[model samples]
Target: MGLLVVAALAGACGYTASARYQPSGATPSSGAAHDPTTDPASATAVALSVAAGAATETYRTDIGNATAAFVADIGTLQEAVDGGDIGAAKSDELAAQAQYDTFRQLEGGNAVNASTLDELATEVAPNGSFAGLHAVERDLWTSGNARADVAGLSVQAPVAQYLLSRDRLTPEAIGTTAVSELGWVVSTALPGREERFSHLDAVDIAAAVGAADQAFAAIEPVGRTVDPDLTTSVAQVFSSLEADVGSLGPPTQVPDAAIPTTLRLSVSQQVDATAAELAQLAARLAPLGTAGAPSS
Candidate 1:
Protein backbone atom coordinates (compact mmCIF):
# COMPACT_ATOMS: atom_id res chain seq x y z
CA MET A 1 0.00 0.00 0.00
CA GLY A 2 2.81 2.41 0.85
CA LEU A 3 4.57 1.68 -2.46
CA LEU A 4 1.28 2.00 -4.36
CA VAL A 5 0.57 5.36 -2.73
CA VAL A 6 4.06 6.59 -3.57
CA ALA A 7 3.73 5.43 -7.17
CA ALA A 8 0.33 7.09 -7.50
CA LEU A 9 1.66 10.35 -6.07
CA ALA A 10 4.65 10.26 -8.43
CA GLY A 11 2.34 9.67 -11.41
CA ALA A 12 0.11 12.59 -10.44
CA CYS A 13 2.85 15.03 -9.37
CA GLY A 14 3.34 16.78 -12.72
CA TYR A 15 -0.31 17.92 -12.77
CA THR A 16 0.32 20.29 -9.85
CA ALA A 17 0.04 23.99 -10.77
CA SER A 18 3.44 25.43 -11.58
CA ALA A 19 4.78 29.01 -11.73
CA ARG A 20 5.10 30.38 -15.31
CA TYR A 21 4.21 26.95 -16.70
CA GLN A 22 0.97 26.07 -18.49
CA PRO A 23 -0.55 22.83 -19.77
CA SER A 24 -0.86 22.61 -23.61
CA GLY A 25 1.43 25.72 -23.71
CA ALA A 26 -1.63 27.89 -23.05
CA THR A 27 -1.85 30.94 -20.80
CA PRO A 28 -3.37 30.59 -17.35
CA SER A 29 -6.95 31.73 -16.86
CA SER A 30 -8.17 34.34 -14.39
CA GLY A 31 -9.26 31.40 -12.29
CA ALA A 32 -5.62 30.69 -11.51
CA ALA A 33 -5.26 30.36 -7.75
CA HIS A 34 -4.53 33.38 -5.58
CA ASP A 35 -3.28 32.85 -2.00
CA PRO A 36 -5.24 29.86 -0.73
CA THR A 37 -8.57 31.12 0.46
CA THR A 38 -10.93 29.57 2.98
CA ASP A 39 -14.65 29.41 2.42
CA PRO A 40 -16.48 29.56 5.75
CA ALA A 41 -18.85 26.78 4.74
CA SER A 42 -16.12 24.46 3.49
CA ALA A 43 -14.08 25.14 6.62
CA THR A 44 -17.10 24.25 8.72
CA ALA A 45 -17.47 21.03 6.76
CA VAL A 46 -13.87 20.10 7.44
CA ALA A 47 -14.26 20.93 11.11
CA LEU A 48 -17.38 18.80 11.22
CA SER A 49 -15.40 15.95 9.73
CA VAL A 50 -12.81 16.24 12.50
CA ALA A 51 -15.52 16.59 15.14
CA ALA A 52 -17.15 13.37 13.99
CA GLY A 53 -13.98 11.45 14.75
CA ALA A 54 -13.58 13.11 18.15
CA ALA A 55 -17.20 12.51 19.06
CA THR A 56 -17.04 8.82 18.25
CA GLU A 57 -13.91 8.42 20.31
CA THR A 58 -15.55 10.15 23.25
CA TYR A 59 -18.39 7.65 23.25
CA ARG A 60 -15.92 4.81 22.99
CA THR A 61 -13.98 6.06 26.00
CA ASP A 62 -17.08 6.60 28.11
CA ILE A 63 -18.44 3.14 27.44
CA GLY A 64 -15.06 1.57 27.97
CA ASN A 65 -14.69 3.11 31.44
CA ALA A 66 -18.24 2.25 32.46
CA THR A 67 -17.78 -1.36 31.44
CA ALA A 68 -14.57 -1.59 33.41
CA ALA A 69 -16.23 -0.21 36.53
CA PHE A 70 -19.13 -2.64 36.10
CA VAL A 71 -16.80 -5.62 35.85
CA ALA A 72 -14.80 -4.49 38.85
CA ASP A 73 -17.94 -4.09 40.91
CA ILE A 74 -18.94 -7.63 40.07
CA GLY A 75 -15.54 -8.92 40.99
CA THR A 76 -15.67 -7.07 44.28
CA LEU A 77 -19.09 -8.52 45.06
CA GLN A 78 -17.83 -11.98 44.32
CA GLU A 79 -14.88 -11.56 46.61
CA ALA A 80 -17.15 -10.35 49.38
CA VAL A 81 -19.37 -13.38 48.95
CA ASP A 82 -16.43 -15.76 48.92
CA GLY A 83 -15.29 -14.27 52.21
CA GLY A 84 -18.76 -15.03 53.67
CA ASP A 85 -19.61 -11.39 54.21
CA ILE A 86 -23.19 -11.16 53.13
CA GLY A 87 -23.69 -7.53 54.13
CA ALA A 88 -20.58 -6.37 52.33
CA ALA A 89 -21.48 -8.54 49.35
CA LYS A 90 -24.89 -6.93 49.20
CA SER A 91 -23.32 -3.47 49.37
CA ASP A 92 -20.97 -4.26 46.53
CA GLU A 93 -23.86 -5.73 44.56
CA LEU A 94 -25.81 -2.51 45.08
CA ALA A 95 -22.84 -0.52 43.87
CA ALA A 96 -22.69 -2.85 40.92
CA GLN A 97 -26.29 -1.92 40.19
CA ALA A 98 -25.29 1.72 39.85
CA GLN A 99 -22.58 0.68 37.45
CA TYR A 100 -25.17 -1.31 35.55
CA ASP A 101 -27.00 1.93 34.89
CA THR A 102 -23.90 3.35 33.25
CA PHE A 103 -23.42 0.12 31.34
CA ARG A 104 -26.76 0.77 29.65
CA GLN A 105 -25.03 3.62 27.86
CA LEU A 106 -24.38 0.96 25.25
CA GLU A 107 -28.08 0.28 24.83
CA GLY A 108 -29.14 0.81 21.24
CA GLY A 109 -25.66 2.13 20.62
CA ASN A 110 -23.99 -1.15 19.73
CA ALA A 111 -23.00 -4.72 20.72
CA VAL A 112 -26.03 -5.51 22.86
CA ASN A 113 -27.91 -7.30 20.03
CA ALA A 114 -30.97 -5.09 20.58
CA SER A 115 -31.67 -1.39 20.74
CA THR A 116 -32.56 -1.38 24.44
CA LEU A 117 -31.49 -3.40 27.46
CA ASP A 118 -34.92 -5.02 27.60
CA GLU A 119 -34.70 -6.30 24.06
CA LEU A 120 -31.11 -7.29 24.69
CA ALA A 121 -32.29 -9.50 27.54
CA THR A 122 -34.54 -11.24 25.04
CA GLU A 123 -31.40 -12.45 23.32
CA VAL A 124 -29.97 -15.60 24.95
CA ALA A 125 -26.35 -15.57 25.99
CA PRO A 126 -23.92 -17.63 23.95
CA ASN A 127 -24.71 -21.33 24.56
CA GLY A 128 -27.09 -20.32 27.35
CA SER A 129 -30.81 -19.69 27.79
CA PHE A 130 -30.40 -16.46 29.76
CA ALA A 131 -30.03 -13.23 27.88
CA GLY A 132 -27.42 -10.49 28.33
CA LEU A 133 -27.38 -8.88 31.79
CA HIS A 134 -30.68 -10.42 32.85
CA ALA A 135 -28.88 -13.73 33.00
CA VAL A 136 -26.63 -12.40 35.73
CA GLU A 137 -29.43 -10.34 37.21
CA ARG A 138 -31.49 -13.44 37.87
CA ASP A 139 -28.79 -15.22 39.77
CA LEU A 140 -27.94 -12.24 41.92
CA TRP A 141 -31.38 -10.84 42.74
CA THR A 142 -33.84 -13.72 42.43
CA SER A 143 -33.83 -16.72 44.73
CA GLY A 144 -34.99 -19.50 42.43
CA ASN A 145 -32.26 -18.94 39.82
CA ALA A 146 -29.06 -18.90 41.81
CA ARG A 147 -26.10 -20.02 39.73
CA ALA A 148 -22.74 -20.88 41.19
CA ASP A 149 -21.16 -19.42 38.09
CA VAL A 150 -22.69 -15.94 38.19
CA ALA A 151 -19.34 -14.40 39.05
CA GLY A 152 -17.69 -16.02 36.05
CA LEU A 153 -20.36 -14.46 33.86
CA SER A 154 -19.16 -11.03 34.97
CA VAL A 155 -16.06 -11.23 32.80
CA GLN A 156 -17.62 -12.74 29.69
CA ALA A 157 -20.63 -10.47 29.67
CA PRO A 158 -18.55 -7.29 29.88
CA VAL A 159 -16.43 -8.41 26.95
CA ALA A 160 -19.57 -8.42 24.84
CA GLN A 161 -20.78 -5.18 26.40
CA TYR A 162 -17.44 -3.46 25.98
CA LEU A 163 -17.18 -4.31 22.29
CA LEU A 164 -20.64 -2.90 21.61
CA SER A 165 -19.34 0.60 22.07
CA ARG A 166 -15.64 0.09 21.57
CA ASP A 167 -15.91 -1.76 18.28
CA ARG A 168 -19.26 -0.62 16.87
CA LEU A 169 -19.49 3.04 17.80
CA THR A 170 -18.60 5.60 15.10
CA PRO A 171 -20.02 9.07 14.55
CA GLU A 172 -21.83 7.63 11.55
CA ALA A 173 -23.73 5.15 13.73
CA ILE A 174 -25.15 7.97 15.84
CA GLY A 175 -27.60 9.17 13.17
CA THR A 176 -31.01 7.73 13.92
CA THR A 177 -29.64 5.54 16.71
CA ALA A 178 -29.77 8.30 19.29
CA VAL A 179 -33.43 9.03 18.62
CA SER A 180 -34.34 5.37 18.24
CA GLU A 181 -32.86 4.63 21.67
CA LEU A 182 -34.74 7.45 23.35
CA GLY A 183 -37.93 6.24 21.74
CA TRP A 184 -37.33 2.72 22.95
CA VAL A 185 -36.59 3.92 26.46
CA VAL A 186 -39.93 5.68 26.70
CA SER A 187 -42.01 3.31 24.58
CA THR A 188 -40.74 -0.21 25.26
CA ALA A 189 -38.15 -0.42 28.01
CA LEU A 190 -39.92 1.70 30.60
CA PRO A 191 -43.43 0.25 30.60
CA GLY A 192 -42.27 -3.34 30.42
CA ARG A 193 -40.11 -2.96 33.55
CA GLU A 194 -37.21 -4.16 31.43
CA GLU A 195 -35.09 -4.80 34.45
CA ARG A 196 -37.86 -6.58 36.35
CA PHE A 197 -35.51 -8.86 38.16
CA SER A 198 -33.18 -6.12 39.30
CA HIS A 199 -36.02 -3.59 39.35
CA LEU A 200 -33.95 -1.00 37.55
CA ASP A 201 -36.38 0.01 34.82
CA ALA A 202 -36.18 3.65 35.77
CA VAL A 203 -32.44 3.52 36.08
CA ASP A 204 -32.09 1.88 32.69
CA ILE A 205 -34.33 4.44 31.00
CA ALA A 206 -32.47 7.36 32.54
CA ALA A 207 -29.09 5.91 31.68
CA ALA A 208 -30.17 5.06 28.15
CA VAL A 209 -31.40 8.58 27.58
CA GLY A 210 -28.26 10.00 29.11
CA ALA A 211 -26.21 7.89 26.73
CA ALA A 212 -28.16 9.27 23.80
CA ASP A 213 -27.51 12.69 25.21
CA GLN A 214 -23.78 12.14 24.89
CA ALA A 215 -24.20 10.90 21.35
CA PHE A 216 -26.32 13.84 20.29
CA ALA A 217 -24.01 16.28 22.02
CA ALA A 218 -21.10 14.71 20.20
CA ILE A 219 -22.59 15.72 16.85
CA GLU A 220 -24.43 18.82 18.02
CA PRO A 221 -21.61 21.33 17.53
CA VAL A 222 -21.09 20.39 13.92
CA GLY A 223 -24.67 19.36 13.26
CA ARG A 224 -26.01 22.67 14.46
CA THR A 225 -23.80 24.55 12.03
CA VAL A 226 -24.70 22.33 9.10
CA ASP A 227 -28.49 22.54 9.52
CA PRO A 228 -29.47 25.13 12.05
CA ASP A 229 -33.23 24.54 12.23
CA LEU A 230 -32.96 20.78 12.11
CA THR A 231 -30.16 20.75 14.69
CA THR A 232 -32.05 23.07 17.03
CA SER A 233 -35.15 20.92 16.73
CA VAL A 234 -33.15 17.80 17.46
CA ALA A 235 -31.65 19.32 20.59
CA GLN A 236 -35.03 20.50 21.78
CA VAL A 237 -36.57 17.11 21.22
CA PHE A 238 -33.84 15.38 23.20
CA SER A 239 -34.02 17.87 26.07
CA SER A 240 -37.77 17.51 26.23
CA LEU A 241 -37.52 13.75 26.29
CA GLU A 242 -34.72 13.78 28.83
CA ALA A 243 -36.65 16.06 31.12
CA ASP A 244 -39.71 13.87 30.87
CA VAL A 245 -37.78 10.69 31.60
CA GLY A 246 -35.79 12.29 34.41
CA SER A 247 -38.96 13.62 35.94
CA LEU A 248 -40.42 10.13 35.93
CA GLY A 249 -38.67 9.35 39.20
CA PRO A 250 -35.21 8.64 40.55
CA PRO A 251 -33.11 5.74 39.29
CA THR A 252 -33.94 3.74 42.42
CA GLN A 253 -37.70 4.19 42.00
CA VAL A 254 -39.64 1.57 40.12
CA PRO A 255 -41.38 2.85 37.02
CA ASP A 256 -45.02 3.41 37.90
CA ALA A 257 -45.85 1.89 34.52
CA ALA A 258 -49.49 2.95 34.85
CA ILE A 259 -49.26 6.69 35.53
CA PRO A 260 -46.73 7.49 32.81
CA THR A 261 -48.74 5.84 30.05
CA THR A 262 -50.01 9.17 28.77
CA LEU A 263 -46.67 10.97 28.99
CA ARG A 264 -44.73 8.00 27.65
CA LEU A 265 -46.83 7.82 24.56
CA SER A 266 -46.29 11.52 23.99
CA VAL A 267 -42.53 11.21 24.29
CA SER A 268 -42.48 8.22 22.02
CA GLN A 269 -44.30 10.11 19.28
CA GLN A 270 -41.94 13.05 19.60
CA VAL A 271 -38.92 10.79 19.39
CA ASP A 272 -40.09 9.17 16.17
CA ALA A 273 -40.69 12.58 14.59
CA THR A 274 -37.42 14.11 15.77
CA ALA A 275 -35.38 11.09 14.73
CA ALA A 276 -36.32 11.71 11.10
CA GLU A 277 -34.86 15.21 11.21
CA LEU A 278 -31.55 14.09 12.71
CA ALA A 279 -31.35 11.32 10.14
CA GLN A 280 -31.41 13.99 7.43
CA LEU A 281 -28.63 15.86 9.18
CA ALA A 282 -26.58 12.70 9.49
CA ALA A 283 -27.05 11.95 5.82
CA ARG A 284 -26.02 15.47 4.90
CA LEU A 285 -22.72 15.39 6.81
CA ALA A 286 -22.40 11.58 6.61
CA PRO A 287 -19.56 11.52 9.15
CA LEU A 288 -16.28 10.84 7.32
CA GLY A 289 -15.92 7.11 6.85
CA THR A 290 -17.65 3.75 6.95
CA ALA A 291 -18.34 2.39 10.45
CA GLY A 292 -15.81 -0.37 9.85
CA ALA A 293 -13.12 2.10 8.91
CA PRO A 294 -11.14 4.47 11.14
CA SER A 295 -14.10 6.96 10.98
CA SER A 296 -11.83 9.88 10.00
Candidate 2:
Protein backbone atom coordinates (compact mmCIF):
# COMPACT_ATOMS: atom_id res chain seq x y z
CA MET A 1 0.00 0.00 0.00
CA GLY A 2 1.07 3.54 -0.67
CA LEU A 3 1.77 6.02 2.14
CA LEU A 4 -1.63 7.66 1.67
CA VAL A 5 -3.43 4.32 1.63
CA VAL A 6 -1.62 3.22 4.77
CA ALA A 7 -2.56 6.48 6.45
CA ALA A 8 -6.18 5.96 5.52
CA LEU A 9 -6.07 2.48 7.01
CA ALA A 10 -5.77 4.09 10.40
CA GLY A 11 -9.51 4.75 10.27
CA ALA A 12 -10.15 1.39 8.65
CA CYS A 13 -11.54 -0.41 11.65
CA GLY A 14 -14.98 -1.35 12.84
CA TYR A 15 -16.67 1.17 15.13
CA THR A 16 -19.35 3.81 14.82
CA ALA A 17 -20.40 6.80 16.88
CA SER A 18 -23.29 5.21 18.77
CA ALA A 19 -23.47 7.59 21.71
CA ARG A 20 -24.88 10.71 20.19
CA TYR A 21 -25.16 13.67 22.52
CA GLN A 22 -27.51 16.57 21.92
CA PRO A 23 -26.43 20.07 21.06
CA SER A 24 -24.69 22.10 23.74
CA GLY A 25 -27.61 24.54 23.57
CA ALA A 26 -29.93 21.73 24.59
CA THR A 27 -28.45 21.66 28.09
CA PRO A 28 -28.79 24.58 30.43
CA SER A 29 -25.69 26.71 30.11
CA SER A 30 -23.72 27.72 33.17
CA GLY A 31 -21.75 30.90 33.54
CA ALA A 32 -17.97 30.89 33.74
CA ALA A 33 -18.08 30.56 37.53
CA HIS A 34 -21.01 28.15 37.63
CA ASP A 35 -20.74 25.20 40.02
CA PRO A 36 -21.21 21.63 38.89
CA THR A 37 -23.55 21.03 41.81
CA THR A 38 -26.01 23.43 40.18
CA ASP A 39 -26.05 21.57 36.84
CA PRO A 40 -26.05 17.87 37.52
CA ALA A 41 -26.93 16.66 34.04
CA SER A 42 -24.37 18.78 32.25
CA ALA A 43 -21.78 17.94 34.86
CA THR A 44 -22.49 14.25 34.47
CA ALA A 45 -22.18 14.47 30.69
CA VAL A 46 -18.73 16.03 30.98
CA ALA A 47 -17.74 13.39 33.47
CA LEU A 48 -18.92 10.64 31.18
CA SER A 49 -16.92 11.98 28.26
CA VAL A 50 -13.81 12.42 30.38
CA ALA A 51 -14.11 8.92 31.77
CA ALA A 52 -14.54 7.47 28.28
CA GLY A 53 -11.53 9.42 27.02
CA ALA A 54 -9.32 8.10 29.80
CA ALA A 55 -10.42 4.54 29.20
CA THR A 56 -9.87 4.91 25.46
CA GLU A 57 -6.28 5.90 26.15
CA THR A 58 -5.79 2.84 28.30
CA TYR A 59 -7.44 0.60 25.71
CA ARG A 60 -5.20 2.02 23.02
CA THR A 61 -2.14 1.29 25.07
CA ASP A 62 -3.26 -2.28 25.61
CA ILE A 63 -3.91 -2.71 21.90
CA GLY A 64 -0.44 -1.43 21.15
CA ASN A 65 1.04 -3.98 23.51
CA ALA A 66 -1.07 -6.81 22.16
CA THR A 67 -0.22 -5.97 18.57
CA ALA A 68 3.47 -5.83 19.36
CA ALA A 69 3.35 -9.09 21.28
CA PHE A 70 1.44 -10.81 18.49
CA VAL A 71 4.06 -9.78 15.95
CA ALA A 72 6.85 -10.96 18.22
CA ASP A 73 5.12 -14.28 18.85
CA ILE A 74 4.60 -14.84 15.16
CA GLY A 75 8.27 -14.19 14.65
CA THR A 76 9.18 -16.63 17.35
CA LEU A 77 6.83 -19.24 15.90
CA GLN A 78 8.53 -18.87 12.56
CA GLU A 79 11.93 -19.34 14.11
CA ALA A 80 10.78 -22.34 16.17
CA VAL A 81 9.35 -24.10 13.16
CA ASP A 82 12.39 -23.27 11.03
CA GLY A 83 14.62 -24.63 13.78
CA GLY A 84 12.49 -27.86 13.87
CA ASP A 85 11.17 -27.27 17.42
CA ILE A 86 7.59 -28.35 16.73
CA GLY A 87 6.53 -28.40 20.40
CA ALA A 88 7.79 -24.87 21.00
CA ALA A 89 6.21 -23.74 17.71
CA LYS A 90 2.78 -24.97 18.76
CA SER A 91 2.94 -23.11 22.06
CA ASP A 92 3.99 -19.92 20.29
CA GLU A 93 1.12 -20.28 17.80
CA LEU A 94 -1.46 -20.49 20.59
CA ALA A 95 -0.04 -17.42 22.30
CA ALA A 96 -0.07 -15.49 19.05
CA GLN A 97 -3.68 -16.44 18.35
CA ALA A 98 -4.74 -15.21 21.77
CA GLN A 99 -2.93 -11.95 21.29
CA TYR A 100 -4.68 -11.35 17.96
CA ASP A 101 -8.04 -12.01 19.59
CA THR A 102 -7.25 -9.34 22.15
CA PHE A 103 -7.78 -6.62 19.56
CA ARG A 104 -9.96 -8.37 17.01
CA GLN A 105 -12.83 -6.00 17.69
CA LEU A 106 -10.91 -3.14 16.22
CA GLU A 107 -11.23 -4.89 12.88
CA GLY A 108 -14.99 -4.96 13.21
CA GLY A 109 -15.45 -1.73 11.25
CA ASN A 110 -12.61 -1.57 8.77
CA ALA A 111 -14.38 -3.16 5.83
CA VAL A 112 -12.25 -1.49 3.20
CA ASN A 113 -8.93 -2.62 4.55
CA ALA A 114 -10.16 -5.33 6.87
CA SER A 115 -9.59 -8.11 4.38
CA THR A 116 -6.06 -6.98 3.73
CA LEU A 117 -4.99 -7.49 7.31
CA ASP A 118 -7.33 -10.42 7.85
CA GLU A 119 -5.79 -12.28 4.92
CA LEU A 120 -2.37 -11.56 6.27
CA ALA A 121 -3.20 -12.64 9.85
CA THR A 122 -5.74 -15.40 9.15
CA GLU A 123 -6.52 -18.16 6.64
CA VAL A 124 -9.80 -16.63 5.47
CA ALA A 125 -8.76 -16.15 1.88
CA PRO A 126 -8.81 -18.97 -0.65
CA ASN A 127 -6.09 -17.25 -2.63
CA GLY A 128 -2.43 -17.98 -1.98
CA SER A 129 -2.11 -15.02 0.41
CA PHE A 130 -2.89 -16.99 3.58
CA ALA A 131 0.61 -17.00 5.00
CA GLY A 132 0.57 -15.61 8.55
CA LEU A 133 -0.77 -16.74 11.91
CA HIS A 134 -3.56 -19.08 10.84
CA ALA A 135 -1.53 -20.69 8.07
CA VAL A 136 1.19 -21.46 10.54
CA GLU A 137 -1.47 -22.73 12.92
CA ARG A 138 -2.90 -25.12 10.35
CA ASP A 139 0.54 -26.41 9.55
CA LEU A 140 1.33 -27.00 13.19
CA TRP A 141 -1.98 -28.52 14.20
CA THR A 142 -3.56 -30.05 11.11
CA SER A 143 -1.64 -29.91 7.84
CA GLY A 144 1.62 -31.16 9.40
CA ASN A 145 3.44 -29.32 6.61
CA ALA A 146 4.75 -26.68 9.05
CA ARG A 147 6.18 -24.58 6.26
CA ALA A 148 4.81 -21.07 5.63
CA ASP A 149 7.23 -18.15 5.26
CA VAL A 150 6.06 -16.46 8.46
CA ALA A 151 9.29 -14.49 8.47
CA GLY A 152 8.07 -12.24 5.65
CA LEU A 153 4.54 -11.64 7.06
CA SER A 154 4.04 -8.21 8.62
CA VAL A 155 0.89 -7.03 10.49
CA GLN A 156 2.21 -5.34 13.59
CA ALA A 157 3.66 -2.01 12.49
CA PRO A 158 0.67 -0.96 10.39
CA VAL A 159 -1.84 -1.92 13.06
CA ALA A 160 0.11 -0.16 15.79
CA GLN A 161 0.70 2.96 13.75
CA TYR A 162 -2.95 3.07 12.74
CA LEU A 163 -4.00 3.05 16.38
CA LEU A 164 -1.80 6.03 17.12
CA SER A 165 -3.47 8.02 14.37
CA ARG A 166 -7.08 7.04 15.10
CA ASP A 167 -9.20 9.25 17.31
CA ARG A 168 -10.72 7.99 20.54
CA LEU A 169 -14.05 6.23 20.28
CA THR A 170 -16.75 8.40 21.80
CA PRO A 171 -18.63 7.33 24.92
CA GLU A 172 -21.74 6.45 22.91
CA ALA A 173 -19.70 4.36 20.47
CA ILE A 174 -18.07 2.46 23.28
CA GLY A 175 -21.40 1.57 24.90
CA THR A 176 -22.93 0.31 21.67
CA THR A 177 -19.79 -1.57 20.69
CA ALA A 178 -19.55 -3.27 24.08
CA VAL A 179 -23.09 -4.58 23.85
CA SER A 180 -22.51 -5.83 20.31
CA GLU A 181 -19.24 -7.48 21.26
CA LEU A 182 -20.87 -9.33 24.14
CA GLY A 183 -23.63 -10.51 21.90
CA TRP A 184 -21.12 -11.78 19.33
CA VAL A 185 -19.16 -13.66 21.98
CA VAL A 186 -22.24 -15.48 23.19
CA SER A 187 -23.63 -16.11 19.73
CA THR A 188 -20.59 -16.97 17.64
CA ALA A 189 -17.22 -16.86 19.39
CA LEU A 190 -18.27 -19.44 21.99
CA PRO A 191 -18.79 -22.05 19.28
CA GLY A 192 -15.02 -22.36 18.69
CA ARG A 193 -14.98 -20.77 15.23
CA GLU A 194 -12.54 -18.03 16.24
CA GLU A 195 -9.71 -20.36 17.14
CA ARG A 196 -10.84 -23.49 15.35
CA PHE A 197 -7.44 -25.03 14.69
CA SER A 198 -5.91 -24.15 18.04
CA HIS A 199 -9.14 -24.85 19.96
CA LEU A 200 -8.46 -21.77 22.02
CA ASP A 201 -12.02 -20.51 22.08
CA ALA A 202 -11.72 -19.73 25.76
CA VAL A 203 -8.82 -17.41 25.11
CA ASP A 204 -10.83 -15.45 22.55
CA ILE A 205 -13.84 -15.29 24.88
CA ALA A 206 -11.81 -14.06 27.83
CA ALA A 207 -10.09 -11.36 25.80
CA ALA A 208 -13.36 -10.12 24.27
CA VAL A 209 -15.22 -10.17 27.57
CA GLY A 210 -12.40 -8.34 29.31
CA ALA A 211 -12.47 -5.63 26.64
CA ALA A 212 -16.26 -5.16 26.91
CA ASP A 213 -15.98 -4.87 30.65
CA GLN A 214 -13.29 -2.24 30.28
CA ALA A 215 -15.51 -0.25 27.94
CA PHE A 216 -18.39 -0.36 30.41
CA ALA A 217 -16.08 0.61 33.25
CA ALA A 218 -15.19 3.81 31.42
CA ILE A 219 -18.75 5.15 31.48
CA GLU A 220 -19.87 3.37 34.65
CA PRO A 221 -18.96 6.10 37.11
CA VAL A 222 -21.15 8.53 35.22
CA GLY A 223 -23.90 5.95 35.18
CA ARG A 224 -23.59 5.58 38.95
CA THR A 225 -23.85 9.29 39.41
CA VAL A 226 -26.97 9.47 37.27
CA ASP A 227 -28.70 6.20 38.16
CA PRO A 228 -27.00 4.34 40.94
CA ASP A 229 -29.53 1.53 41.05
CA LEU A 230 -29.24 0.74 37.34
CA THR A 231 -25.48 1.05 37.46
CA THR A 232 -25.38 -1.38 40.36
CA SER A 233 -27.53 -3.80 38.45
CA VAL A 234 -25.30 -3.53 35.39
CA ALA A 235 -22.22 -4.13 37.51
CA GLN A 236 -23.76 -7.16 39.19
CA VAL A 237 -24.84 -8.77 35.94
CA PHE A 238 -21.42 -8.11 34.41
CA SER A 239 -19.84 -9.78 37.41
CA SER A 240 -22.06 -12.79 36.93
CA LEU A 241 -21.21 -13.02 33.26
CA GLU A 242 -17.50 -12.80 34.00
CA ALA A 243 -17.74 -15.50 36.65
CA ASP A 244 -19.54 -17.72 34.18
CA VAL A 245 -16.68 -17.30 31.72
CA GLY A 246 -14.15 -18.03 34.46
CA SER A 247 -15.90 -21.32 35.22
CA LEU A 248 -14.75 -22.62 31.83
CA GLY A 249 -11.17 -23.03 33.15
CA PRO A 250 -8.09 -22.60 30.98
CA PRO A 251 -8.07 -22.42 27.19
CA THR A 252 -8.58 -25.88 25.78
CA GLN A 253 -7.70 -27.79 22.64
CA VAL A 254 -10.98 -29.56 22.12
CA PRO A 255 -14.01 -29.47 19.90
CA ASP A 256 -16.77 -26.90 20.60
CA ALA A 257 -19.14 -29.63 21.79
CA ALA A 258 -16.83 -30.41 24.69
CA ILE A 259 -18.23 -27.31 26.40
CA PRO A 260 -21.37 -28.17 28.32
CA THR A 261 -24.70 -27.09 26.88
CA THR A 262 -25.93 -25.86 30.26
CA LEU A 263 -23.01 -23.52 30.68
CA ARG A 264 -23.54 -22.16 27.17
CA LEU A 265 -27.18 -21.47 27.98
CA SER A 266 -26.19 -19.73 31.17
CA VAL A 267 -23.64 -17.57 29.32
CA SER A 268 -26.21 -16.65 26.68
CA GLN A 269 -28.71 -15.61 29.34
CA GLN A 270 -26.21 -13.47 31.20
CA VAL A 271 -25.15 -11.81 27.97
CA ASP A 272 -28.75 -10.97 27.13
CA ALA A 273 -29.37 -9.49 30.56
CA THR A 274 -26.19 -7.44 30.42
CA ALA A 275 -27.00 -6.12 26.94
CA ALA A 276 -30.50 -5.09 28.02
CA GLU A 277 -29.24 -3.25 31.08
CA LEU A 278 -26.41 -1.60 29.16
CA ALA A 279 -28.73 -0.47 26.36
CA GLN A 280 -31.05 1.07 28.93
CA LEU A 281 -28.12 2.86 30.48
CA ALA A 282 -27.08 4.20 27.10
CA ALA A 283 -30.60 5.46 26.39
CA ARG A 284 -30.85 7.12 29.78
CA LEU A 285 -27.51 8.84 29.44
CA ALA A 286 -28.26 9.94 25.88
CA PRO A 287 -30.52 12.77 26.98
CA LEU A 288 -28.52 13.92 29.99
CA GLY A 289 -26.49 16.25 27.82
CA THR A 290 -29.62 17.58 26.20
CA ALA A 291 -32.56 19.80 27.27
CA GLY A 292 -32.65 20.42 31.00
CA ALA A 293 -35.37 18.93 33.20
CA PRO A 294 -37.83 21.11 35.10
CA SER A 295 -36.75 22.01 38.63
CA SER A 296 -38.31 19.71 41.25
**Predicted structure with the largest TM-score when compared to the true one:** 2
lDDT of 2 by residue, 29-99 (tens): 22336433225345443454444445455555666677778778777877888899988998887777666
As a whole number from 0 to 100, the lDDT of residue 121 in candidate 2 is 43
Clashes of each: 0, 7
Q: How does each model score on TM-score?
A: 0.67, 0.71
Residues 1-296, candidate 1: write the lDDT tens digits. Answer: 54454334422321112222221222212233421112223444345444555666665676677767767877777676677665566456556555555544344345433322223455655664553345545655664332344455454646645455434344545554665666667665657556666666666666767766767787676566555677788788877777776666666555445436777676566656666666665554442332332221
**Local error of candidate 1 at 296, Å?**
14
Best candidate, lDDT:
2
Shift of residue 286 alpha carbon in model 1, Å: 1.5
**lDDT (Cα atoms) of all candidates against the true structure:** 0.54, 0.61
